[model samples]
Target: MNVPADDITGAPAELSVAEVRTAFQAWLHAKASELGEFRNLSTDVDEIFKSLSRLQRLLYSEGWIRLGWPEEVGGLGGPLVLRAVISEELAAAGYPPPFSFGTQEVLGPAVARFATPELAAEVLPRLLRGDETWCQGFSEPGAGSDLAALRLRAVDDGDTWRLSGEKIWTSWAQYADRCVILARTGSLESAHKGITAMLLDMDTPGIEVRPLRSMNGDDEFCSLYFEDVVVPKSRTLGEAGEGWAVAMFVLSCERGAAAWQRQAWMRWRLGSLAADASDLPPHTAGEALELIHILRLMSRRTVRSLSAGEQVGAVSSFDKLMMSTAEKFLFDTVLSAIPETLLLTDNESARDWRSDYFYSRASSIYGGAAEIQRNIIAERVLGMPKD
Candidate 1:
């Protein structure tokens, strides 16, 4: 609870994921008296986000969030899996991660790997501390599955690059401070090779964010418009034409490592259902439990692969596919077994179930669509010939 301040000049000791988890759990128990009670507060999405942000900042300030990051980036330095373990423990304990946690997993790695050391040192700490939020700018109206077809254009200027295009289904863009944007920097004929990645400030002139409502009754996704937005050369990620690699790296993290966190949350939801659903049909509970078990097994392998710095590559498609199947299956079970609670109850517990069930539909859509993951698994992982 009383983490020492960052040692600017001194080398910090590295801690393994297990050690960090044990320390964090011990700290959580020690601070249990001061920590706020976990509430289901599911109705107000903004309020829930605010509360989660505050929680992340608290953990960040105490140095827990910095454990797995590099000392140069304000972390104590350890295997990145340490952070993953922390997230799993938190979610298993019934604490929803701070809304920005996904950003750390999805975007943080790419930046840390490709960004200038100065940039990584300057920006990543802020992200860890919840002082800033970042969003991916990959999917476009026509580029959802065919990302190589994205039309966003970024032309190099002497001092800054000019960007113009639209990105759709960008989550939390309205609340994000920075975005890892992909744009066409070469000819349309170049396909993925011509694309480039850039880190742009959300407040840049000529940029707009329009929130889109989901079936869950929340504005969690947004459509972003970039009209000749100027981005500094320093904002570029990797080489001018290496955006595709950066994008692939980000997607791999999303599909592979991020799935671990989701599995942990799913397992927690399964336990909650078992505890609360008194009238649940036996078969329904059994099916949900089976799905959770499958997801946990698949995600555990993916997490270990990622933690070991393995390429994972097309193999991650299997993990993504299983995760989507498991998520939808578990939530469908919830809806069927607890229809009254999901549809009619107005309490926070019921609202959480309803909202989660609605959001579960997107599980197959985000990261990559279920169809796309299957296609990858068939063509790449299994080496099956494309039809």
Candidate 2:
């Protein structure tokens, strides 16, 4: 797709974060009536996805979402922090982010950094425009938190490689058009050193997606089964046997940039909880707000560091750990403040509350468990001895 015309919104190619935020907030206000519909969305995951996809398209057309992306890859060309402002301002305005927001931050960076320029130019725009959704196929049945132990195998076949493995807890794989998957191409004893990251089309033969129902009653997570699936050698990310670096980069984004998005959403939820819970104690609400603020500060630092091409390394573990802590605290406090609404009410708002509460229970477990985060900090950050 061609870059958005200058006359569309007349935004400069390079904009400061404040300018981007002011312009975006102005657009949101001017289009409030048009954007109001997204303030309240369906509880059904598929319906929510469909609705947000439209929102993403609208943002793309307006050029807000294109800011901070390179012109070579369908972006308007600015610092990445400009893109972060879009999601923050959207949530602050009571709008849900596009369905692919998390994937865009988590996987998009890795692909941009490691994929061939031709591949990045071809696919990144589709992802940014919400024309396609992607999933991360890192966590296997044997390697949820211990990602280095993944047993997925990818055997070389000259022009292509054959992948056979099972990936569990893959979020929204059922709706993905493509997936970035990690497979072992070396000896089992090689651990992380043997891994290779490859991008694959989800429609490829020998792939099966089974949606697993979460406690929220939404099939948000899925099991991806690949039986000798063929992937071109060209799709390999970085050099073979060097996937560990790619994986680390992806994890850093997942734990950092994605956390930025999550904290924004959490702050929105905190505001709603404060409004709904008439009897909520001031102290309880204050504490939750404090945790959320701490998360925002930490996540912002990480996002900016990433925008400047700095490696955050093990420091991102703190962001992941605090994110889960703040999320669980906010939802737990919400449960305490309005037990009846979350437990017995059948309305849309109540269902959202119930769903959020249930999903929050997994906050400590998903995306590298809290315990694992602590271990990383102890060993890598604090320089403490491992067990």
Models 1 onward score TM values of: 0.94, 0.97
Candidate 1 per-residue lDDT, tens place, 1-387, comes to: 333233311332444445566666777776765665543444666777777778888888777777678889878776777778888888877788777898898899899988989998989999998888888899999999889999999988977899998999998898899999999999988999999998989999999899999898889889998898999999889999889999998998888778888888998998899888887788877877787787777767777776677876887788788888989988998887788999999988888899899999999999889999989988987789998
lDDT of each: 0.83, 0.89
Error of 1 at 294 (Å): 2.9
Q: Number of clashing residue pairs in every model?
A: 0, 0
> Which regions of candidate 1 fall more than 4 Å away from where they truly are?
1-16
Please give the TM-score that candidate 1 achieves against the real structure. 0.94
